[model samples]
Target: MNILNTIRERRSIHTFKDQEVNTELLEEIFTYGSYAPTHYMTEPWKIKIYQEGGKTAFVDAILASYQRIGMLKMDGSPKSVKMNDSMKKFLLEIPHHAVIYFEKKEDLIRYEEEYASVCAFIQNVQLAGWEHGVGMLWTITPYMHDPQFLKDIGLNNEKVKIAAVMQLGYPDRVPKDKGRSPIQDKLEIITD
Candidate 1:
């Protein structure tokens, strides 16, 4: 498939089937992501992939954080847990979860550059997955920044920041294209 066509058709997949994503396909996606360019030789991106039985830690940590911060109000309503558990249930439905992060650096400019590189890397992964008929949704839940939650996910570093949590799987349904603003509105040409 042409790259432009993929970009035009790819949509954020929120729901997925019960099938698991192919391991070899995921490896290929990551391999392509690793080729994303960085300003310097420093590779600042880190990813922790969770799938199958490995998803427990990530889900538990997120639920715990939500409960900790009173995001899930247990006011004796029997259906409250049902409502609050939707996110958890949806997470379980997906075949894979990828935690993306950027390592911190002392230099401000270098830190920004590293983060930009990681962002580009994420875009590459998404595009590559779409080419394979897989889809990914990138999110940054409040729990990602919680120290206890991070520790539960085996990340105890004060120097690393969670950039996103990407959910990946074959889409149960593909969303229709949502048009964006005209390029002319955001673009500018200047030559002096």
Candidate 2:
């Protein structure tokens, strides 16, 4: 498929099929992500791939971290759950999870640049997945950004930050294209 078509057709899929994704396909996706342009060639981004039992481990860890933060309930109570039941419903449903992280730069000006690189990496992964008939969803939840949880996940807290948790799998349902706004209205040209 053409790159532009893939980008336009790709959607954030929440429902995934049970079919297992082969390692070779995953390698291809990661390779695409690795090629995203990075500032200063730092290549600060890192992706932690979780599949099979690993996904379960990740979900559990995230839930546990949320429970520690007390965001599960407004008021502490026995019935208060860290993660809503519905949210948990989808957390364990995906076939794979890729936790994206980026090493922090001491220079504050470069932080946003590194983040933009990570975002590009995410787009590359999603595009690659679409080309390969796979599905993907990028999520940035409070649990993913928690300091302790980040540390527990082996992300370098001193030098890195959790960017997002991306779910991947075969789609259970293919959604129709949701058209985008015209680019002409959104763009501004300056020639001086």
Candidate 3:
């Protein structure tokens, strides 16, 4: 598929089928992610791919971490939880989960650069998935930022930070295209 067409067709899908994503396709997506631009050639992005049995374990760990942090309220509680049982259930059923991390650079500017690079990387992955008829959802639940969980994921607090958690799978339903704002409204031309 053409890049522009993929970008236009891609949608944020929260629901997915039970079918597993092809391993080669997943690798190709990651390869695209790894090619995102970065300052000083410091490729800081890291991704942990979880699928099949690993997906269950990853979802359980996420829920457990949220519970440990008091983010999940008991049933019928007044303080509505941001991540409810339904969301957790959906996560557990997904065919794949990718945890994206960025290693922090010493310089502040470098840190920002790394983050921008990671964002570009994610965009690349999303577009790549769209071309393959797959759907990808980027999430950053509070549990993902938990210190203990970060440590468990082998992310160094001193040097790396969790950027996003991307859910990947074939969509159960293809959504209609959503319109976007006119580029002219946001674009500007400078003259000296």
Write down the worst ten-residue block by lDDT for model 2: 74-83
| Cα lDDT tens digits for candidate 3, 1-192 | 788788788999887998988899999988887788877787778889888777666776777677779877556554444456665776778888899988777888878898998999999889888888889889978976687777766666776788999988999987777898999999999997
Misplaced by over 4 Å in model 1 are 74-76
TM-score, ranked from best to worst: 1, 2, 3
lDDT of 2: 0.82
**What lDDT is obtained when candidate 1 is compared to the true structure?**
0.85
**Residue 133 displacement (Å), model 2:** 0.5
- Model 2 over residues 113-167: C-alpha lDDT tens digits? 9999999989898999889989988898888667778777776567778888898
The C-alpha stretches of model 3 lying farther than 4 A from their native spots are 74-88
Cα error, candidate 2, residue 22 (Å): 1.1
- Provide the overall lDDT of each model, using Cα atoms, as 2-decimal numbers: 0.85, 0.82, 0.82
